[model samples]
Target: MSKSIKLLAMFGFVAAVAACTSGQTEEEYVVVNPEPISVEPTYTGKYK
Candidate 1:
């Protein structure tokens, strides 16, 4: 093959690989539970 044709093919292959890898990135989300739990009192206070 000619030098120019070989160079063009190499450039095309590099561009294709770059495009494919560019779409493989992923983003993640982190969740945090911020609500407080409610509970009944263990004992009742007697009136003085």
Candidate 2:
């Protein structure tokens, strides 16, 4: 029983540390690169 309590406490401490450190310390920037406005044309016609 004592061992189980100690393990639980240790696990809780590790979880608390992880949660605290993961609080978004830096701002997240979403970089959006737009696709080209015009697409390349393909030739589908027969030439005489």
Candidate 3:
């Protein structure tokens, strides 16, 4: 009877802790906007 009571107490404590805790983690999302790329001007001539 004494061992059974101790085991019951241990199981209750575990159950209480498990009930209070969130098992899964919350995921955070990050959004990134890419910058626009500009094209360089074409070379007209080597020298003026």
TM for every model, in the order presented, reads: 0.54, 0.52, 0.46
After superposition on all C-alphas, the RMSD of every candidate to the true structure, in Å, is 5.8, 6.3, 5.4
lDDT of each: 0.89, 0.93, 0.88
| Candidate 2 vs 3: which has more TM-score | 2
- Tens digits of per-residue lDDT, candidate 1, 1-48, equal 699999999999999999999989977889998876887667667863
TM-score of 1: 0.54
What is the per-residue lDDT of model 3 for residues 1-48, given as tens digits with 9 covering 90 to 100? 999999999999999988777555668899999887987889889985
Candidate 3 residues lying further than 4 Å off, grouped into runs, are 23-48
Taking the candidates one at a time, how many backbone clashes does each contain?
A: 0, 0, 0
Provide the lDDT at 26 for model 2. 75
Best-first order by TM-score: 1, 2, 3
Q: What is the lDDT of residue 19 in candidate 1?
A: 97
Better of 1 and 3 by lDDT: 1
Clash pairs for candidate 1: none
lDDT of 2 by residue, 1-48 (tens): 999999999999999999999896978799999999999978878872
